[model samples]
Every structure is written in C-alpha cells, then in structure tokens.
Target: MNKKVTILNDKHQRPPEFSAGSCTVTVYSLQPWWRVDLLAQYQISSVVITNRVDCCSQRIDGAEIRIGNSLENDGNNNPRCAVIKYTSDSSSYNFSCNMIGRYVNVIIPQNGTTLTLCEVEVYGVLGAISLQTDVALGKIATQSSSSYPMFLAPFAIDGNRDSNVYAMSCSYTDYYFKPWWRVDLLIEYQISSVVITNRGDCCPTRIDGAEIRIGNSLENNGNNNPRCAVITDIPAGSSSTFSCDMIGRYVNVVIPKNGAILTLCEVEIYGVPAVTKKINLRVKFHTSEDMIDSTTRHNVFQQFQMVSALKLYWTQEPELEHENKGFSDPSPVHYIQR
Candidate 1:
C-alpha cells in the first residue's frame, strides 16, 4: 500500500528515493483534492504552496486554490483564487487570495492529474475583531411570548445554536403569530453588529421578514425603535451577521405580521460601553497684595493660559471686587478645554 497521506504532515524534504514516502500518488480522478481547516475565520491575504523538490514537480501545475467557510463538497466548490501554472526545481509558488474564510482547498478537475502539496502556508488576520466589537454575552433576554414547556424566552440569549435538542438549542414562540424577542444591554452602547442563528431541525423559513430594531426607547414594546436590517434568508443551523453601527440600549427582533412564526437559536451583540468624564478646578486669593496693580492682574491672566488643561477666552474686562479686604476678585472668566 502507498503512504499517500504523508504529503500533508509538514514534511517538505526532497525525497531521498521516490517510493511514496513523502509524495502522493498521481491518480486519475475528478475528485482529487486536499483541504486545510483554519479552525477560525480570518481575513486572508495570501497562500503559499511548496511543491515536491524531487521528481514529478510538474504534476502540481494547473491545480486550483480555493478559500471559503463552507464545507460543501469538501470545500472544492468554493471560490477559486488562482491556478498554478508551473514552479522551478525546489521552489514554492505564492498566490494572493484576499478573502475571508476558515477552509482552504486545493483541487484538480482533470483526470489522470494528481494533487500533491508538500506544504501550505496561510497568512491572515482575525476577521471578527474588525467586523464587530467586544462580545455582549451574559446579558438579559426576553420575548413577546413563549411556547411553554422548554421553549422559553431565555434560550435565545443562552449562547447555544444547536437545534438538535429543540428546547435547549432554540426558543419557540406560540403559533404563527406576531412574535418578538429582545435583549437589554443594561446601558447604552455604540453597537457594531448583531448575529442571529436560525433553527436547523425544520421550519427554517419561520424567521423570514423579521426586522431588527435598535434604540434607547421601549415604547410600543420596543418595536418602535429604529430599524436596522430585515431578514431575507438564513441557512438552517447557520448564523447570519448584520451591521448596526448605532447607539442603543435594546436590540429587538420582531415579525410585523400575526401569521408568521418566530424561532431563534442564538443571538449575539457586539458594542462598546458609553462613559462620561468629569473635571473639577479651584482658585484662591490670599491678600490684596496678590493683585496690587494692573500689571499683576495681567500676569495672573497670562498664567491662566499657560495651564494647558484650561482654555481662556478674553471676553470683557474683569469686574473687580473692591469690597473684599483681601485680593480683589475679578469677574469670573469663562473658558473651555481644547
């Protein structure tokens, strides 16, 4: 038997002898392909392929490189980046594939063509960070209605998308009615995006026409909030992400009609919390000697501008407090920070 699986194990050394030791057999089949799982999604920049340095280096020509998140057809049906033409002896070929995916596949469609990959190097950055902010997990979840038993309102925010168990994986609302679900972020945030998971077992079309709304208002059951996006289609047991770069305290998903059912497996929010900054200042004068003359008053005003934290605007002449035996108090100066 030939050890055909040795080519994918990170051993790119030139074969000392051609005996199926570090190379795959050149077989005649339309389904000859090799796949690499990146474990997570990434904004890929390029892919590097190292060809076998020994004999049969020409077999890698015409091979296609594909990248995508789908596992359909072993990822061979994904989008193609480039096709390899030829490589010199003991050399590698580089292909720029600026796409986002978790799987990379190498395929050859012609018969009698063997797909051999000595080594494959992928370079990319974390795609999720750029698309969304920090994860809004462990927040409060509620809904307009529930179906009782196990399909409660809290399942949508529990962070589980598996529809196999039904009750635990998804939350089902009563009948085909105008149902709604919402999450409370406790405080206002600059929302970046929202991800929703659809039921996988059956009736995936129940979530069609659902509208996502975000705002700081709870009037009309949070349905009156600003509309973000409307759901058109989502694959069964899959999640779809939508961008909502707005400021809000609530995220609501509601079906406007009364005949449509609502089933959501999971809901995730990403945003940044809002914060306020407070500043305090105090000024004191000891005696009238502090401002004995007009020159001393000018020096005091100039010193105020030197303080980088304060921005002074010379409006009108200061109102001198002549009644005080201590330093004369000037009219309050109005200023703002830069």
Candidate 2:
C-alpha cells in the first residue's frame, strides 16, 4: 500500500552522437597502363577512418561501413568492400577492398554515433607505355678534291653496283694498323673502270659488301663484276675524276686491261665522329630485379666515355721521324757578317 505514492521518472537519453572527424580513402593502380577493359584491381591497405568522440563514457558496440560507386546498401555490387569494428579508445581503423571503377566513396557509422563520411579517392594501376623511333642516317654526299686523278672522272654511285670502286689503293705504314683520315688520288690516264677491294689488314669487316649510294642510286658494275662498280671509257692520256661516298682507310681499285696510271689522292677517314646532336636515353623501372642499381648504371656510363677516348694509333718506323726532321730543319747560323 505504500508504493502507491512513489513515482519514478525514466528519461531515455538520446544515444551518444558519434562522428568520424576525418577519414582517408586511397586507391592505387598496380598496372603500368590504365585500361578500363582490364577491370582495374587494387590493394587498399591503408583504409583508415578517424572519429572524434569520448570513448570513456559511451562505448561503441559496432560500426557499419560501405565503399563502392553507388551509395545503396548493396551499392552497385562493387567487387570491393570494407568493414570495421571500433572501440571508444580506437584512434583509427583500417580496411582494404578491390574494385574496378574510377571513383569510390566510403560511409561509416557507429552504434552510438552519427554517420561520418570521408573524402572520395580514386586510384588505378596502369601498364607501362612507350614508343621508340628508328635512328636515321641522313643523306650523305661524296666530294672529290681538286687534285683528283686527271684520268678519272668524278663519278657518283647510287649504291646499286656490285663491285663499285670510287678510290684506288694506297698504303701508309703509320696508318696500316690505325684508322685513316682521308685519301687523295691522281690519275694520269683515262680511267676505264673502278673497283674497290679490302686490302688493309685492319680493314673494318663492316665495310665488306657494303653498298655505296650516291644521291639515291646504287653504284653497280655494268659488266656484273663480283665487286660492285661503275665503268667509264675515257680516252687515253686524258684525266678523269672520281669520289668516295664514305671515308675509309683503304680501297683497292681495278684498272682496265690497258692499265692506266692511278695515284692515291687525299684520304679523309678516321674513327667514329663524335655525336654533336642531342641524344636521349631513357631507362624504365619494371620490377625489382629489372631495376638497374645506381652503382651498375654509373659504371656503364663511365665505360662509354673511356672507350671513346682510346683511339687506335697505327705503327710507324723510327726512321721516318729522322728523315722528316732533316727536311724540315732550317739552315744553321754560326755568325753574322756586317
């Protein structure tokens, strides 16, 4: 009977409002080239969500999160999803999901807290893409010196000839083993034909069977000789001119059966010329194994310049210097008379 006057007020305190202060959603594409058709796949490792709330008084029993293109519960059925169980003391929670879209959104909710959203982040892995162009050797011209063989006419070859010869044989003991700078030739009689042969012991193998083109045509043997060539029927005792498309150390020429006198003109050949134009060489990182380490890369660059400096010096006779000095020395003066 005493309980009739007792009344208790039960106030239902609204559930503690919980909210995520800041959240970050990052996406990364592992492929080299981004292709939508490939259905982009990614590893979402650091999917962290931060919440600003008091964990001591109210405890968070559970958390619900959704990430995808659409915001629905099923959310476009994105192939990726992230869920987290957080406590009041938890500072940040991380989850991972894989999806194939250019955009993604993350929604987070706590049992006793208001829903929070993080800024959307999009990421994708693309495949390596590159393009390469062929190195081009521009038009090359052959020039003949004024002292060209009077019997040889300056003939141009378009590189069609089989045994085409633009120069005659000449030997320099000093340059026998070393590369030649240039060649000069003089002919006294009319040159009937020209043929080039590899005569020097150190002739570059790359020169063998190489075609010499003039303008745009090939220099070919009109008679189908084993060597590529061009023939001219100049009259006897007359001078003709000829030139070489490329500078080389030595070239052998075949005189006609009547054998006319041919002189070695000036030769302009030497080691590979230094590149004056800009050149770009790029290296890409494909994998840990394929990556070129710093040490190895530096060594390669150093070796290139070292080899370029090592020029080939031909052997020479000691007597040649004595003779040259004798000819070049000026007359000795003992005393002057007034």
RMSD of each: 15.8, 35.0
lDDT of 1: 0.69
**Per-residue lDDT over 1-338 for candidate 1, one digit per residue giving the tens place of the 0 to 100 score:** 11112134356553433454654554667758888887888766567777775667787766777888899998987765556656464457666544568888888767766777666677777652454343546777788777575877667777554543355857777765678988888888878778777776677677889999999789987889999999997645546667888788888999999776788887777778754343443344444445646787787778777876655654544444655454445555667532
The window of 10 residues in a row where model 2 has the poorest summed lDDT is 1-10
Q: Give all TM-scores, in the order shown.
A: 0.49, 0.20
* Model 1 ranges off by over 4 Å: 1-124, 127-135, 165-167, 275-338
Query: At residue 30, what lDDT does model 2 achieve?
Result: 22
Total clashing pairs for each candidate: 2, 58
> Mind giving the per-residue lDDT tens digits that candidate 2 earns over 256-320?
32312222222111123222223232222222221135564445345444655332221221111
lDDT of each: 0.69, 0.26
Model 1 weakest 10-residue run by lDDT? 1-10
State residue 135's C-alpha deviation in candidate 1, in Å. Answer: 4.1
